[model samples]
Every structure is written in C-alpha cells, then in structure tokens.
Target: MKKIIILTLSFLLICFLFMQFFRPKIVNSPASADFQAPPNVKAIMIRACYDCHSNATSLRWYDQIVPVYWQVAADIKHGRESLNFSDWQKMAPADQKSKLWEIVYQISAGAMPLGSYTEVHQNAKITRDELSTLKAYVNSMAAVALPDDTAKINAADRQYSQWRKEQFLIKQVPIAPNGVRYMPDYKNWQAISTSARFDNGTMRVIFGNNIAAAAVRTHHIQPWPDGTVFAKVAWDEVEDKDGNVKTGAFKQVEFMIKDKEKYAATEGWGYARFKTPKMIPYGKNALFTTECINCHRPQKNEDFVFTQPIKH
Candidate 1:
C-alpha cells in the first residue's frame, strides 16, 4: 500500500512538471495608443477590464498554472478581439464612441468582465458607483453633439432636403454586405415600439411585419416564428427650448429577418442596415455582421432583439 502511494505521487509530480513547459505566455506589449477617457473612468476600466480586454494583462500566481493559464490565455485572446484599449485611437472617432457605448451596454447587461474572470479576480468586479459614473460619461458624449435651438432647426431642415433628394435619386434598392436586401415594405408595417435613447441621442421606432405582429398578439414571440421580421429606424433626437423631443435628421434603418435554417449562423436572424437618407448600405464586407451579432449577444434570450412590442 505504501509503495503504491509513493509511485502514484511520483507520477503526478512528473505530469505536473511536464505541463508547466506548455503554459502559454501572456505578453504585455507596449500600447500603440490608449483609450482617452476621464481619469476616474479610465482607472475603473483598468482595474476591472485591463486584465483580459487590454494588452496590459496581469496574471496572479495561481492563474499561471497549466489549465488556469490556458483559460486565461483564451479569455484574453477573445476579450482583446472584442475590444482592445491599446488600439482605441486607431478606430474612427465615431467608432470609438460606439465602442464605449457598447462597453456600457455589456456592463449594464452583466455580460462584461465575465463572471468566470471576476470569480478569481474580485477587484475586476464593477461596483454600482463605477457603473453610474460610466453611464454619466457616455451620456455626456451626446450633449457634446447638441447645439443651440437655431442650429438644431437648420440641421433638421438640411437633413430633410437631403432625404428628399435621396428619395428622388436612388433608383435601385440597396443590399447589405451580408446579402440581406433593403426592405422598404417595413414602412407599411405596424409600429410596435418606440425608444428615446439619450445616451446616443437617437429616437428609434421598431416596426413588425405581419408574422411578427401575429406572434406578438398571440404572445408566441419568445423565439418569434420563422419569417417574423422587424425593422428598427432611427433619427437624431432634436430638442427645443421647452425640452420637448422629436425625431430630427434621418440616421439609419436596420432589419432583422428571421429564418432558422437560412440565418443559422447569425442566431436565426439576418441583419441589415441602411444609413443616411441616401440609404447607403452598411458593412465593408459580410464580416461586418460579426459586430452586429456581438452587440446584440446580450439580448440573446429576447431572440437577440432589444424591442418589446406593445399590445395591438
């Protein structure tokens, strides 16, 4: 019995020693450029997300062990792929704001910093105060875009004229990079929901097709029947001195067309976006849908949708 136990211990030690050689390296290369935010907000992000989301990763001693190290490496790889603070300035200004907005969204949905990570690194867990601060900062970005009442009216009028010109000039229905066609029929669909997103300064209306409407009426929209379609149209939110809000400049329109088999890769829904009044299609390539899917991932339980339809 004593001999057997000794042999087993020896074998286990050897296995452990061999595995150490295979541990993956976590490199902390100097950042090319970093995300620019208020010092407080940046400090919070560094404490909570830098471990995996940024190039400046720091692993605890236990985290460097074989299996744990493997997982940490993988998490860092995917986390950085999603958003790397080191590469922040490389993105366009609009893209930077969008990414920050997405970060706030993921955190709000409890889909960020990853539960698995926070379990081991308690300091990485965001506090309520930190979340509140982040929200305030993001919302403040919209205020930067706001102008005086006279400028607001001028901007709206300019947008309206451009919209008319686009309607007259565009002869062909544009198609998204993902092969989803521009769905003009959504204009005839029922408005199912409306939202005023002050964080992004956009007013949005969600429209549902006959199939989606029927599913909603019957309360069968948990997964929503295949063929159910939704269109989300957005415009710049214009506010007057009295603080009343209305849709101003045309921003974009997006569609979610459902087909379990056809759109199996994208959570059983095809996504398309037409931007500006000219209806320019979004995406440089089909891979652009990856960004869309990532953004909607937190709402997967809601069939990857953010809108809740009103009772008709």
Candidate 2:
C-alpha cells in the first residue's frame, strides 16, 4: 500500500510540473483610435467574444494546466480565424458589413460563444435585451441600397412620387399664425440629407434633409413607367464627440428593403456610414448591397434583417 501511494503522488507531482510549461500564446491586438464601440456593445463583446475573437482575452488561472492549455489555444486560434474582431477594419467595406450582419444572426440563434464556451463562462450567455440591442446595432450597420425587384420598386416609387407631389403642394400653400410650415420635403431640405440620386434611377434620402428637387431634376421628372420599381434608401445622421450634429454620416438602423425580400435566402444588402474624412472608397453615401446577402441567409424570417424579434 505504501509503495502504491508513493507512486500515485509522484505521478501527480510530475503532471503538475509538466503543466507549468504549457503556456498558450496570449491573444491581444493593439487598440486603435478609430475602433470605437458603443458602450453596451463593448460590454457584451468583452464578456462573451473577446476570449476567442479579439486580442483582448482574459484567460483564467486554470487555463495554465497542460491539457487545458492545449484546448484554450485551439479555441482561440479557431475563434480568430472564424471571426477576428482585431482585424475587422482591415476587411473591405462590403466584407465588414456582411460580418456585422452575421454576428447578429449567430447571436440571435444562440450559436455564438459556442455552448461549450458558455458552460465554463456562465456570463457569456446573452440576455434578451442584450440580444435585441445587438440586433439593433447590427441592423443599423447593415442599412444599404434599395432592392432591385421591379414590382416592389414600382410601389415604392409611387409612394415617393405622391410624397414629393404633396410636398410641392405644401410649399405652394401659405401658413397661418401658429401653424408651422408643413414642408413635406423637410428631410430632403436638411443640409446633410440623402437627396443625391444615381443615374440608375435610385433615390437616396437622409433622415433629415431636403433634396427632393435635386433628385427629381437629376432623375428627370416623369411618372414611373408601368412596372417600374422604386426603392427607398435611407439613413440616420452620425454625431460627433462634442454632441455636435453632423449629417450624411452613417448611423446604424434596421434596414428592411424590398430587395431583401425578393432575394430571400440568396442575398441581402449591407451598409455603413463613416465620417467624410475617413476616405472610405465608397465615400460618405456609398452603398454595398451585393456583398451583404451571402451571409444574411443564416436568418431568413427577418427578411435577412438581423434585428431578431426578442421572444418573450
């Protein structure tokens, strides 16, 4: 018995000693000034995603154990390869948009952080509101160009034309005392509005800007031909640090455009808005719909929209 006990103790001691040498490479990336995260989004990511997907990992003391160390390293490496938060900005604009949408789909489906992960890290489990907030942010980031479906486009165009004509009538009518000017084109009239129209017959309208006249003139004023479709591409304004209001900047919002429905499982559009000085290839008003759809099929009910309805 004494001999057996001695051997057992010796084996345990040897295993512990060997574990000391099993050090996994730490995951961390240098922080950049441009990489800003909304406070809530930042919190959830740190608690759940940073361990695998980011350079900012918070390894536990037990992870130093030999066999565990191997698992930890493997998980980190796989996480980074699948989706590395550290290298997000390095990807093309379209790629960035698609990934953002995918993140939402995974979280909503409860597939993120992996079940094995949440088992050890209890806090990694996402709450209902956190999921909703994440969905909202992802949706905002993915706001993109209008769909290309002919039927939907025609309907949207008719609505836009009616809205424009109503605005014209409002402009012609006089206002009474205490009655504010009901400028139907108030959104377009805003300095940083989405009034720019592309030659392909699409209208870009910002949340608050007036460019209806400009869009009409540029697109050439005429009623839509039968079967002609019109889709509305829209966005909110981006704000600065000092609380100064800036226009034409991309603010994340839920994007449920016609093309998303038409394309269904095939594809979805993704969009993001940054500051004018950022010098992004697409400029402040750039749209990237083609690249967004490939990943959005992961969630079909929401019409490729990432904002999953929080099940009570």
Candidate 3:
C-alpha cells in the first residue's frame, strides 16, 4: 500500500511538471495601428480591458501557472477575436463604428471586464464615472463627420419611419380595452440579440420587427426612427445536473414601441410589460413610464435599448 501511494504521488508531480513546459507563449506584439483615445478614457480601458483585449497583456504570477494559464490564454485569444484595440485602425471605418457601438453596449450591460476577471482584480470593475467616460468616447466616434456613406444614417431614419408606419397599420397586435394582451409573433421576428443578467436572475431574448431590423442593419441606432418596435422576453434560469444553465420558467415579456409624434410624452417611446400569459400591463398610475425610463437611462445614448445588433 505504501509503495502504491508513493507511485501515485510521483505520477501526479510528473504531470504537473510536464504542464509547465506546454504553457501558451505569452507574446507582446507591436500594435498594428495605435488606437488613440482621451487620456482618462485610455487609462480606464487599460486597467479594465487591456489584459484580455489587447497585445499589451500583463499576466500575474498565478496567471503564468498551468491550469490558470490555460484559461487566461483562451480568454485572451477569444477576446482579440471579438475586438483587438491594438489593431483598431486596421479595421474598416464601418467596422470601427460597429465595434465602438459594441463596446458601449457591453459596458452598459455590465457584460465586459468579465466577472471572473473582476473577482481577483476588484479595481477592474467599472465605476459609474469610468463607464460614462467610455460611453462618451464611443458616442464621440459616432459624431465624427464622415463621408456621405456613413452620414446617410440620418436620411435613412425618415425612410424607415414611413416604412414602419405601413407595417404597423397592417400587423400591429392589439391589446384589450383594459390594456391586457397576449404575446405576439415575436419568435418570427428578427432576433436582435440575447442577454443574461446575473444580478437580476434572468435571461432575455430580444426581437425586432421589419422596421427595427432595417434600422439596426443600417447601423442607425440612435433617435430610433419612428414606428420602431422591440419585444424582449425573459426567463428564469435553471441549472441542470451537469451544471449547465438553461431557460426555466417564463419570467416576463416587455415591449418598446417608438412613435415620435404620438408617444412624445415618454421620450417618443412607449414601454409595456406583461408578467404572465394574461398580458396585464406592468405598474400602476405613472409608475410604468417613469420606471422604464429610469431603468434605461444608462443606455440613453443607444436610444434606451440594451440590445445591440448580433454581428454575424
């Protein structure tokens, strides 16, 4: 028995030692084109996102060890594929704009600076001021004076509005006189994106209609053009025996309907929530509009929507 135990320990040590030799090569490559940002904005990004998303990764002692190094390597690999700030200018103008939008959306949704990464580097968690700075930087990119190609987003808004009104007349679902309704044909609509909110105990799938789809495809995210409508359905998440989580019970469904002329009282968008199949509207006398805007205030620049276009 003693000899067998000694052999087992020796094998384990050998395996650990072998893993060190196979560690991923951590390289600090030169930036293809140095991405420029305001001093404060650059500082925040460096502290929060650089390790995973840039070539200038600074790994800690444990980050160089075997199993942990494996995870770090994979994260950096996937992160660069998503968006490499080091190669920012190498991307086309349209791609740069799209990437900027994604950065703002992810940060606003509390999806970036990954939770696991922030667990150890607590300072990496974004504070409100830093988040605002990052968002402002992204918004500034959108405001830059580009050629007619990127500048046409404004003209496209009017065209989309006329198109949306036509669709609304033909296909808009109705609610009862008491403001109750059932879920509409959202599954058939264009899927905008999906999101999970660990802080809220829910996962959501967002859908957009023809008008919203056109606007998103055109990259006209702000001011949201009239007649745009969105449907977001959320569900409780349940963990299976394998520790994988899946959508459990139906939690709720919400809608954001945009009509600049008619819904001008609520920032040109009307909000509604249905907590059950009965589809009773959420909230009491003034609570709905007030609460909806308050919750979405952080994403005001994205036209009060948290979901961004899913880049295929």
lDDT of 2 by residue, 158-255 (tens): 54465445422222433212221122333344332343222112234433222323433355213211111222233233323454322332222212
Number of the top-ranking candidate, with lDDT as the measure? 1
Q: Select the stronger candidate by TM-score from 2 and 3.
A: 3
**Each model's Cα RMSD:** 4.6, 17.7, 18.9
Native-to-model Cα distance after best TM-score fit, residue 173 in candidate 3, in Å = 20
Off by over 4 Å in 1: 1-17, 90-92, 144-173, 187-193, 197-200, 210-225, 297-312
**Most TM-score-accurate candidate:** 1
Order the candidates by TM-score, highest first.
1, 3, 2
The whole-model lDDT of each prediction reads 0.84, 0.51, 0.71
Cα lDDT tens digits, model 3, 1-312, are: 999999999999999999889877768799877567789988888889999889999998978889889999988987876667898889887666666666766786777777788998898899998888876776666532223332343434443353334332323354532243434666578888887653334568898888899998787767787878899988655554455555555556788888886777777777777664335557765446776775565466667777767546
**Tens digit of per-residue lDDT, candidate 1, span 59-117:** 89999888788999988987788789988889987778768887887787777778888
Candidates in order, TM-scores: namely 0.76, 0.47, 0.50
